[model samples]
Target chain A: MIKKVVASVQEAVQDIFDGSTIMVGGFGGSGLPEALICALRDHGARNLTIVANNVGGVQYGVGILIANRQVRKVICSFPIGRRQAKLQDTFWEQYRAGALEVELVPQGTLAERIRAGGAGIAAFYTPTGAGTGAAQAREVRSFGGRECLLELALKADFALVKAHKADRMGNLVYRKAMRNFNIMMATAANVTIAEVYEVVEAGTLGAELITTPGIYVDRVVEVKVERRWQG
Target chain B: MQATESVADSRLTERQIAWKVARVLEEGWYVNLGIGIPLHIVNYIPDDREVILHSENGILGMGTRPPVGEEDPDLVNAGKEPVTLRPGGCFFSQADSFAMVRGGHIDVAVMGALQVSERGDLANWMIPGHELGNIGGAMDLAAGARQVWVAMEHCTKDGKPKILKHCTYPLTAPDCVKMIFTDIAVIQITDAAPLLLETAPGWNPQDVQKLTEPKLLFTKPVKVMDLTGAPANK
Candidate 1:
């Protein structure tokens, strides 16, 4: 049997080094790998780059890493809402001070970049950021009357994803919108570690239900952490 | 440009502005309402129209908030607040959701703005000097939607106009806004020019132009946005 199970979340992420780029999957707290994130924070890897929808709030989800000052960069959509208007006051303190770098991508562009990395596409043009500051750099081309900018693919060294269920062989299934960025992140990373609620035998997860194939997953760690609900 | 509000009542609250935005929604349109003022639109939508609401976080056909005790922890809009999904509504990945947005499947996107130029430049994502900024999916929606509409206050709380000759902030998208629904007026953008189409109840075209820096063209007679359910004329 090709073994993919890891003894613990720590062991699963044991190889991550400082400055390693990580793609964490989730929208807000739902479907986040809480155990893996907490483990990463405990693992004490500094200067990490996080790619997600956002870091989430202070008391929940990836905010722990942000609050701990472990993150060096974030490539995200909205890092904070309008309520965090006092920007220098929150996790953004480092960003404003230039200690942390933020490469903000439009949500669609971010998703497509990750998907492109997994699919082996080197670059593509998108109209999302055209004619705006987001389109400031690189190449701009006109396609059928609409101008678009070329966006490159993005890949990560490790991807932490959450799943509702998984099989020992690593086939995975996600629940609801929580699967937000997990499916692509799983394939876009060199080492995809899945934190799942339940694990079954290799064939237990029906072929129809599996959203991600095990071949893309390098490790499977079963976790008992319930999905975080921001609401 | 197609339709202007016929109602003459002005003291348009956030809810009232939403009621006017709702009037523009045609039945069977798949709409995405941005946070802030745009969210109020769900409350005033006419009951007869069947509109499906889409959220960037991967929900479609999402309804208004469930009653207090009925909120579902896992069910929420992209904004992270509890929302109710109508029957036949489904959830997907954020990638898939943005594909729908970027792929041009969404019909309308109603959002707020910090600055909108006469040329339809949108600058909602950031204000200069802000510590943190996130553009999110608004750019995608602005670029990909069949039509993009802006609902915003006519002026800032400090009495500065939001509609200007040129946007002073970072742009979200260029030449994308089709219609602007403001508290004091409804202005249509035609060939990068603002057409003063309607005035609110108590305000006139002069009241709107005084605060608005851009040269306003009084194209076509002005009317008022319908505010049927608005708080009884303030």
Candidate 2:
């Protein structure tokens, strides 16, 4: 059995290299792996491709990386700031200058693509982008008399996630609707790192309550109080 | 406008009610049709009118349903069911899609209804016994739309009345429904009360009252129209 628990998020993501693709799990403001992200910023890794639901809110969460210019490209479903007009100007300026590479994915397809990556599927066809700009560069196949666009699988070099609780062996429990993308992306990366609010002894977490099993997790970090952005 | 006559007009069948409701749709309206019974509205949209459909999953300018054997697994609506897009359609992130909804870009939102109260309060997302999934973007759509409409059967499958004095299920939007299109009648919900506008063919206002749990307010006499030959189901 692999030992997964660590003392801090900094230790969990210690080996991530520059230019690596990383998956950060969260939905809107909930269930974000903040400790791991803060550690990534502290490491100052650059030219990274990030896959996430949102780029976090302004002044906190994923915005920290954006503020530091550590992220080169972002693949996300939404990019909203907590305070409107705060980051819009900066984002627009960077986007217009082509300084930042951004690719927006449909929420459902994004979730499925990550899930497919974990499941070892190369690509899947769907009708979501049959006649839109989103279908550019993708192969279109007609299935069952309907046109479907092919979407490739998305995998990351590292996966960072936040869970409500976990055992020393890394079995995770998510709080309510916060489970979102963490469960699927946990298995879609080469190194899966998890930050938990509470860590218990191995076998303490019931099998039925574990949303993500220990088999997929490589490192576990325990975090104290979660910091919030006042803005 | 008498109570007895008004109640008589409110008890039509689902198909019959859908056809009558279709006439109110204007051309070139940006509309978001919710899952379930509201989806049936697509079958009744007028061919002459260009209705741009927006899905919360990030597709705008959607077309009629695709043909069999051509279903695309990736091409789905907000409900995660397969869908087809119209010419000149665009796809974006769920964030942008919601920006369209929350920014007041959508003109109308037609949703399925489990319970509609006399006060026009709507409770459609969850019931007491069902397991609730993500609210997705329904709450935002319902709260942000310029107008909210509901389409549902007159009564539940178990013969329980859905039109109530007040909704008991978890609410998707509070007092957001402007008009309710039911198998029995088309009731326009105003700030004051729900007024009976039209009734199903053959069903009297009395028949409607018997099936409805709430006391419906009638402002004027209602007429029943032929709702057959609405748009073909896609």
Candidate 3:
């Protein structure tokens, strides 16, 4: 029998190595896995490619990894700041200095790509980036009176996510809007580790409310500092 | 031409423009408000209507900005500013959120634009010679939204016309804008061309024409929208 519970974030993240492609879930501050990220940072894994909505601001989220020079590339839609106003982001500065590489994907396209990876679908077509620079060099096809670009699936070696609650079985239920990318990311990664606020007894949590089933979750760890809820 | 004095006297404040945009929102409609001026629409959504606000970050049923003292550190908008979620509002992953957008679940999308063409093309994301260019969610919303509305000033801060015959800047989305609410007028884009639906109070058709690059059709029947009326939510 495969046990899902882990004693510490560092133990769950011990396998991550240099040059690993990782999917870090969350949008801004909503569903970020803070403890696992800190563990990865402390674990000293380098040369990583991170995929998420934003790389994060100056002192938060994935920005810490960039600040530590752990990341080598990023695949995302939005960069750090307001497009018109410009961002003083560490990642942007790194990219400008030729120390990093970036592949810009449209928001919907990025989501579908990750979803496709989790669902075992090879590739799909989307109308979201038909003619913009996002569609650059991709196959263009006309379907049902609309033009679309072919987008490929995105998979990762490890996925780290935050969930509001979990059972000992690893069935998860996320709180509010913080579930961004965590659910899909669970199935897409080779190993998925969840940092939950609390671990309830298996039968105590209803099966229907679980966002990511235990089959998709490899390990679960309780975060020492539980996230605030509905304050 | 009896030009109303107010249009000539002052520029519409950002909050005022947001209030005007709020009036156009329909009750029970799921709306995605883009960054910048459209963000202010949250404060002005009428209390009477139950318009659901969505963020590209995966939150729907978003409420107005919370007071300084009561902010939940975990909750924020696409802009990363602290916000409150409304009753029955829930969060999902980035994939699910974009599914709502690309799947056309959004009823209306209000966004800010740098320039809009007579053909309703939008150029909002990038300009030539910028340091870094990232579009965020505007491209998806513009391409997938049921109805696209632009909320911007009549002219650039340097007094350049934004509504043009053709956008010289890089395009964000082609032929996407259905209506434009500028400080000086409300214009509707149809298959034929831009129709002058209404002029700002105290401004005449000619005054609007002078500031607009494309030739605007001064249709005989036009109304000056009264912003003082209750917002859609109210």
Instruction: Indicate the residue-level lDDT of B134 in model 3.
Output: 72
Between candidates 2 and 3, the DockQ winner: 3
Each prediction's whole-model lDDT (CA): 0.84, 0.72, 0.83
Error of 1 at B106 (Å): 1.2
RMSDs, each prediction?
Answer: 3.8, 17.7, 3.2
lDDT tens per residue, model 3, B1-234: 235445546456667778888987999899999988899899988899899999888889989878867777578887767889898898877777888887899999999999999999998888879855677888889999889999999898899999999998777778899999888788999888888988766777888899999888878867876756633322
Ranking by DockQ: 1, 3, 2
Highest TM-score scorer: 3
TM-score of chain B of 1: 0.92
In terms of DockQ, which candidate is strongest? Answer: 1
Model 1: per-residue lDDT, tens digit, B12-116? 778778888888899899999898899878877778888898988888988888887776556677677777888778888788888898888999999999999
Let me know the TM-score candidate 1 reaches against the reference structure. Answer: 0.91
Docking class of 3: medium
State the lDDT of candidate 2 residue by residue for B178-220, as single tens digits. Answer: 9888876778887776777777666667777777876667645
iRMS per model in Å: 1.9, 15.3, 2.8
Poorest 10 consecutive residues of model 3 chain B by lDDT? Answer: B1-10
Error of 1 at A146 (Å): 2.3
CA shift of A125, model 1, Å: 0.9
In terms of docking quality, model 1 is medium
lDDT of 1 by residue, A1-231 (tens): 788888899999999999999999887666778889989988999999999888676555667788778889989987776553433365656876777888888999999999999999999999998998766686999999999999999999999999888887888987666678898999999999999988888777889888899989999999875443434
